[model samples]
Target: MSWVLGLSGLYHDSAAVLLHDGRVVAAASEERFSRVKHDAGLPVQATRWCLAHAGITMADVTHVTWYEKPLRKFERMLVSQVANFPRSASAFRRGTFNWLTEKLWVKAAIVKELGVAPARVLFSDHHQSHAASAFYASPYAEAAVLTVDGVGEWATTSLYRGGPGGLELLGEVLFPDSIGLVYSAFTAYLGFQVNDGEYKVMGMAAYGEPRFVDEVRKVLRPREDGAFDVDLSYVSYHWSADQSYTRRLEELLGPARFPGSGFDPTTAEGKRYADIAASVQRVTEDALVAIANVLHARTGLDTLCLAGGVALNSVANRALLTRGPFARLFVQPAAGDAGGAMGAALWTWHEVMGNPRTLDTPVLPGPGLGQAWDDATIGALLTDLRVKHEVLAPDTVAVRAAADIVEGRVLGWVQGRFEWGPRALGHRSILADPRRADMKDRINARIKYRELFRPFAPSVCAGAEGRYFDVPPGGEQLAEWMLLVAPVTTDDFPATTHADGTARLHVVHAAANPLYHALLTEVGRLTGHPVVLNTSFNLKGEPIVSSPVQALATFFRSGLDVLYLGAHRVEQTGSYDG
Candidate 1:
């Protein structure tokens, strides 16, 4: 049996994935193990876990693949910094420091981490890794692929054609023009952290009008061939050390909003931020649509597979599904840097090893590939924490949790395994009754302690999805992963629906996750509605709670009413301020 280890790191969201034969066996992020949000180190713990999970030592792996090439990235950094000169000094210093320490010598580092010989280590281009992860894991046998993100070595966006065998690069949009960076610059200007808070900006956009759509269009000039260029004069990210948007950008937008600055969404300042967000989101849609159209025009492939961090934009994904050229879409659940692990492994499997690819059958592996704890582990944690808890029978955990949720109690549902991506899915999640209009406000203000505008996703059993939302025309293709947004027609579940009448839906199947599905089934039985408000099980500025200990701590600290850990149940007796 051939075992290949894939790793993506030395950048944000460092992660590792192990493939046995051709199937994904294990995958995890460094943040969960390191307790650092978006840890960008060598993913030592994650690598160790993958090895341990497969019951093999590092030396047992036939090959090790890194997510991206190092020298090429260093070249981009050096050239971009030198071209920008004095303005790039700050970013240069940061990049050089990182390169000197960790970013460079990736092959050496991987060997050291694995205790393997140097010859076993290999690397793929960042975009190639992203492309491989999407196409290899997707259900499509032959599909057009797209990967877009902030600069990776040099390329920022790439398109590919992939079949059962492997992928070929069709086109690419390189450095100095990137939608991801452009959006990130605005994310910074909107007084939010980059990389992490772009989703928040996506959510905030729904609140504002596209008043600045034309003004922002001056920056994102589209090309007839689906390539776009940014007005460099307005973007300082190419030059500025830390700041991404230049003074010219602030001038164009009128003024830069300070971080933590208060403004109502209905007010003028709020409206301005909203309008800018709307314009940028619209531009992003335009670019993605154009790219998809081009991919279709060239490949004539009805199926599309996408990865890279920008593919995490559900809004653009929806636009591609509805208005763009693709008939079917498959976005790897963990489409960001975390997914590079899968890509690196696949690149080695298909490209280097000369192994032919096979189409994944209808049964797509839902991303529940992280670590899981049994009842014994949960019991030990409860004993150590000295928390009050009861050990219910395995068959009754979901039913009990569903009853509590039906009673309007927010439940921290920690079961089976942790999800492999940014989304919680069924494994690591806080669940509430979607029918309660007050549920959204309560969770955001009390349990999540996040912004009021942040929207929560709805977890509907596949059978119940059609009752509430208009599934994409292709029907039940992309819903399983919660990668697409669909309009919810039913007003009964207002709490789960966003301002735009759309809900980021996770269509759960009983076969994929029995307990979570049973819980939703029970909830439907009680309330006559089969939807639950689902969000990542974590507080703001924290990675998704990984271990049972973290989940318990999060539960005690937040206003969550109860936590169901497999056969265990721990209810929060503390009063919530909200």
Candidate 2:
């Protein structure tokens, strides 16, 4: 049996994936184990966990694959620093220090970390990893693949054709002309963290009109050939990591929003920022649509597989589904750097190892591929902690949880394995009543402790998705992964719907997650709505809870009225805030 360990790190969202005999055995992000949001170091703990989960040691592994080529990336960094010269001195110094210390010696580091021979280690290009993660994981036999993200090695945006043998790089839009960086620069200008705050900007966009689209176009010039360029004069990220935008951007628009300042949409400045957010989001969707159209024209394929940081933009994804030429789409759940781990492993198994592709090899069981605790272990922990709880069967647990949700009680739902990606697809999620308008605010203030503007996603029964969402003709695949933003048809579930009447909806099929589907079915029977407001089961700035212990801790720390852990129903007797 061949065992391949895939790793992605030294940037953000480090992760590890284990492929046993060309099948994905386990995969997890470092943040889950490190408890750091977007941990950038090598995923030591995650690697060990994956090895343990696979019941193997590093010595048993036949090959180790890294997501990206470190030397190639370092070369690109050196060239960019030289191109920018004196202005990039500080960034150059920092880059040089990082590379000399760690990044340049990635192969050596992997060898040392895993205690494996140097010959066993392999490296894949950054875009290749992203493309592999999308196309190989997708159900499609042959499809067009697109990967767009901030600079990786040198390429920022890439197009690929995936078929029996492997993926072929069709074309690419190189660094300094990246849509991902352009969006990130605007994300920074909108008073949010660059990598972390892009979603917040997407959420905030719903509140205003795209009044700044013309100005945003000046920053990102889109061409008819599905390629785009960023106006370097307005962007400073290439020269300095400290800031994404320069003074020219402020002059083009208005004063940049100050970081950490609360968003007040009623105020003129707040309204202006919202408009800018809307404009950027619109421009991003336009560029994505253009790119998708080009890929479709070239490949003439019905299905498209998308990966990379830009692929996480559900709004743009939905726009592409409805308006672009592709009839169907599949986006890797962890479509960011974290997913590169899985991509590296698959690329090695199929492309490098000369293994033939199978029809069933690409499909995942579900997103809930992380660790899970059995009832006995959970019960023992609850007893040890003196937590008041009752054990119920799976069906009863679903029924009670549905009742609690319908009664407007927020619940911490932890069942089965935790989800592998950034989304909470039933397991490790906070569920609440979606019908109440005030529910969103309550969860934001009492549980999440996040910005009120950030919208929550809805977990709906797969068959019932069309009842509430204006799902496009070919949105089934996108909805299954919660990768599509669809318009809400009714105001019944106000909490889940965003200000723009759209929602990032997760369609839960019984075959994929029986317990979650049962709960949604019960919820439908109780309230005529098969949807529940769902968000990741974690507080602000923290990774999602992975273990029963973390789930219990978060349960007592937050304002959750009920805690569902496997077959146990935990109820806090008194008000105890951690």
Query: What are the per-model numbers of colliding residue pairs?
Result: 1, 0
Say which candidate scores most in lDDT.
2
The residue pairs found clashing in candidate 2 are: none
Model 1: CA > 4 A from native: 360-364, 574-578
Tens digits of per-residue lDDT, candidate 2, 1-578, equal: 99988899999999999888777788899999888999999988999989998888998998889999898888888888899999999999987998899888888888887787999899999999999999888888899999999978999999999998689888999988999999999999999998899999999999989999999999999887777888899999988969889999999998999999999889999999999999999999999999988888888888889999999999999898888998888897899999999999989988989887777645466787778889999989888877878889766989999999998889999998888789899999999999999999999998889999899999999888888999897778778888889999988988999999999999999988999999999999999989999999999989999999999888888888889999998876553323
CA lDDT, every model vs. true structure: 0.86, 0.90
Model 2: residues with Cα > 4 Å off, grouped in runs: 575-578
Model 2: per-residue Cα lDDT at residue 80: 88
- TM-score, candidate 1, is 0.97
The number of the candidate with the highest TM-score is 2
